[model samples]
Target: MRLYIDPGTGSMLFTILIGLVGAGIYSARMLIVKLRFILSGGKKVDMNANRIPFVVFADHKRYWNIFEPVLREFDKRGVDVVYMTASPDDPGLQNPYPHIRGEFIGEGNRAFAKLNFLKAGIVLSTTPGLDVYQWKRSKEVQCYVHILHAASEATLYRMFGIDYYDSILLSGEYQATDVRNLEKLRNLPAKDLVEVGIPYMDEMKVRFEKAGPAPKHETTVLLAPSWGPEAIFSKYGDQILKVLLETGYHIIVRPHPQSYTAEKDMIETIMKKYPESDRIEWNRDNDNFEVLRRSDILISDFSGVIFEFAMVYDKPVIYTAANIDTSVYDAWWLDTPLWTTGILPRIGHELNGLNLPMLHSIIDECLNDTRYAKGRDEARSEAWEHMGEGAVRTVDYLMKKYRELNPAERPDKEA
Candidate 1:
């Protein structure tokens, strides 16, 4: 009796059988937690425990955008917000919570603060080392919201961003949809994702609503370029400073913080060369978005600042990817034609300007181009809708999660 299972049927059967086995394994693991921890551990498990956390992550930088709001929320609730730091010598360590000033606590104990938060019905997380360091405690009802300390763009940035939180705050739908399809979250279990727009944009919005007239004779342009495989400095980067400064434009050389050393040296050399050029200024300490809010134009590389500027400021952007390797850089920018997608696919502008004359011509043409200005405005409108204007929406959602639960019901931190 030859009861033959065809190869195709055999493969299908094998797959289904494997799936069942994997499911069985997960089911067994859950059963063990319930039976061993809850049933056998025999300690009365508080079926209801407080879980709304006083949110802030390790070594919280004081100047962060969300600092004030998070503090206000915790104070209203009578909970202490946690802050960790490596610099004990840092002046003015005044706060309601215990500040653990220690060597970047070893990974094993990095989440040492989480236990404290869990005891207080809260979980605060930031950065790669801390996110993975804790969360293994796995308090099912705990609220774990991640307030990104910085803005995100590019597919690669989000992909590398998955390891450290319970919930994510997205800038807008493009970012949400963009992130949803990203290959990075593919491995992550589905969790809550929030699209409340960026928190700092809220700060930008307040000033804009009370918007006063701009300073006459002062048109500030921020020169921001990425710092990586194809940094602006490698390309016609210096050309921007020389052309804008030599002319009469108010140029603010706000390069990436990562370019601190290079930018410093460049600024020193340029200042000596152009002592009479007071029209251009250098401001590194300004909030990035605030600078974008005031800028008349943005000269950048493949930085997210371009998308933000295009969407928010609706201003002309002159990009010089001349130093970027065709093999590596993604040529798809917000709306203006990219060199890779058959959208004006080949620009031969120099990426550097160390005594180069062509760079000046490129900057002049871009600043003066009517078509470039129109495209920038159009792109900004689209980005504004996509990014949304409410940074408070993210905070509101975090608060909503708190209101839904009984704080007294969250699990207490285990000793």
Candidate 2:
């Protein structure tokens, strides 16, 4: 104390002391993790296994509809695939295929996700931005494949995230052209973008075929909007529901799942205000096929459901123009300069969300008018031209890429 050290010197000394302590703690924690890994035989099984692991990563249970059929194809072909999900409580892991291994990595736990990825030889997913930025496992897997869950264009995803994928499976020509344009614009390496149709829709079409057509009714309209700031549910949910309900047409309100996350209170209030009648109902079921099959016409706002409804059910849709202010998204909208082009007069009749009178008019027109019927057919054909039998092709592509990567350990023949 009598030495009278200067304030600057004392501050520097304190900073150094804190840094040393932090580094010491980090080193100790890492040492413990390494020891635990060894003790738990993680490396032993992962590194020395005779069969290479094929993994499908799912971020949510909603995607089970897409991955289940593809996983079934693998099972049928005698391929042993592992299903890894971020949700620990995901129901998909409960009754997994006999040959398929299911693992649930802790949700939002990057360390566990990386550990799971380290064990996978080939990884496939429809979930975008898997470990692209933080705690990346890009180098862990031999090949990472991106499958389009929606028919939207490539710009909907971050360019850097798409770049992280080794291959992409497109649903239609729009996605293919968009990916190529992105590749040229960003000067990034060309990714293997194959038009594999909609893999999820393949299964739905089979079910629909088996179920046959739904019975016609007096104007059944499903109001299925997407999630986000521009979502019709947030802006005109009350007005739209009120107007449609008053019209006495059977209405099914199937808001996007993410809508609950963004506006839970608002949705709850809507439900309480408008008690459900046989004529009106709020649906939260994970499966939308039944809703789409039953509904005669759909009224939505810039949602992928527009394409799914139009292409799958072969019906007309009334779309609300997206007056989206992307600025609120923290520069996220900058990635997709062409996002609006994906939806528009391309598939549905466009209308302003706030215009109640016009919205009602368009609903009537969509129900009765045959002029847009031809346009719907054209759009459906162009969007899902490869609808049927694409799941088989997707499995074929996965195996092909797997063989290319592991030439030495390739399967002698396809199962």
Candidate 3:
């Protein structure tokens, strides 16, 4: 007698509702613009005439690390950038940057409403799915630039995520190749793809260097998984943790930030099942560098953190076999295997149903093995080119495109 809606249906309905609200807001704003033009005695009005030159939109505070270095570069060069975020308490809002003006633009549909009617010369963002979901292209905005927040494949995003962007700043050349291939497959115009290494990773590297070496402690295993139906925790439940706990090694469980929100029930159930104790710990720090530095081994499932731990900390990773539904993502369009999955064997060992029981032995093997060192070096080169100069390169590309869009405002020296 009870009607139930599946997650897919619920998500579709929610997206539709947000789209309707955004369309209504857009219509209202357009009406106001028309009225203003009419009141000016039939004179044409340029909506973007008073638009800001550069804008950076951060949908969540988690991406502040990625945008911080770029904004710092803008601040250093004395270039003005509007930092708009949906999170009211975003750290970016409190950054001590003179040239970067930060503002909290509300969350969800409200944020979409403001962005849908945005007026700007150039807008750079780490958030994708622009023009495909609630966030639509603004007529007044000249260009939309997307920067990679992770050192993974660009095609890993949801279907049509980067397809609508004017330019894409990549972490590696291989990602650019994937983008170009996708464009060709979709018959879309080529977007400007600049290989600008991982900016946050660069920041992490600096922080790690300054922190010196981590003090000696018990061998720790960090379980950091992505969130969603295909995530390790979602698919395998507490089975993975059960096996790890039996290993008698100290364990640090750091669920993806979204897990606390999107998969609340699942997370709560798991946490209740295994309460924190001396041997087990839960980590939800805003900055993961300290925790990552302290840990020796990482266990993850398709999360970008695998690359972070392996490349940044030079640690071993034990990846789980989670068959992600690529049909719902841009990966479906590609014939080649994912670079993340392909590189896993080289950087870490696989943990699946068969190996679940041998987790402890596998952990011992990974700790004792140093064979993946070469693969990690190769991955770093292939996935993160121009390592130490990410922020500078990112700002250079954004400024170049800005100058191209606004020739009259071109400065003598690029930022």
Candidate 4:
């Protein structure tokens, strides 16, 4: 007799087994620690090795961009900020800052959530699900503020994980609406939702304004796609490139950081097939904003970068109809009509099939056509209410939260 197993089934089983074992180990460790405490005099664990007024936590270095502008604000205000991470190799820990202190809090879900003594007056982060799931110690900080990294729709954002945050900083009206709706749906308390635009994009706008005219390049098309089974690369990776190359347009294919590993085999195969040429470049660099800055237009599938491109430069974007695999992730996002709620439809021309002529026509329309121009501008304005001065707003909000937490510490008003 032979046993048959689907690859997906095997993978799921492996993940479940690992998760169970890890949970068991963590429970046992916590139990032992508690027992030791009861056996002896009630002694406190010193997880708060370096407690600071402002503590910022990140899951990995990739999220460092979210904290960059905040850190700069902290520096300017002469406020010392403590940076903590669960990633052992986060390079942000190495970046020297006079007002910022860094610490690598080890790795794994247990280490990430076992942080009980790491106390702070005001904690701020873009990372979701902080100290809520991996461990039961959720109230490790006084005030927790969540900053929005992506300006996507409601259900697409983290569900219960976001609820744990005391305050949420939103970039646009869409996010604020989502939070309000989620609160009503879940019967949860109204969170302190502030409409502070994304900090990085605010900086991007300033940089773009200060910099002279972008260097002229032959009409360049950037193919930057999100990582998944239904990504542009998985659907028609090489075919898209082939068509673009034939059209005499410069092509830059920038894969998501995870895509290089998640779909390594296919990505490598495509790169090998089409070696680097003057007309094509495979971008491995994680910094895609520069790539977006250089490209004439963007070709993407359901990536948040679409909002960044359209809202910032007012450039045109060509998007593939999102091909989401419900089995892999959230089903609710698919259950609801995301396109109807979000500004995606208004900003870009959505392409369904891989028809070359249709694709070419859409690209042309994006470049020169004025049919959707007004709609795009209107959507951009509505979505990014605080378009340019997001960092300032964020800094102001953080300071207010800090003051609220430590009323006595705030300076007294003079007569």
Best by TM-score: 3
The residue-by-residue lDDT of candidate 2 on 248-273, one tens digit each, is: 78999888887787788888888888
106-166 per-residue lDDT for model 3 (tens digits)? 9986898788878898899989899887787887789999998898889888999999999
lDDT of 1 by residue, 222-257 (tens): 777766547666554455566666656677776677
lDDT of 2: 0.71
lDDT of 4 by residue, 9-48 (tens): 7655645654566567657757876887777688875443
Which of candidates 1 and 2 reaches a greater lDDT? 2
Q: What is the TM-score of each candidate against the true structure?
A: 0.60, 0.80, 0.87, 0.81
Query: Whose lDDT is higher: candidate 3's or candidate 4's?
Result: 3
The candidate maximizing lDDT is: 3
Give candidate 4's TM-score.
0.81
Question: What value of lDDT does candidate 4 attain over all alpha carbons?
Answer: 0.71
C-alpha RMSD values across all candidates: 11.6, 7.9, 4.0, 5.8
How should the candidates be ordered by TM-score, best one leading?
3, 4, 2, 1
Candidate 4 minimal-lDDT segment of 10 residues:
326-335
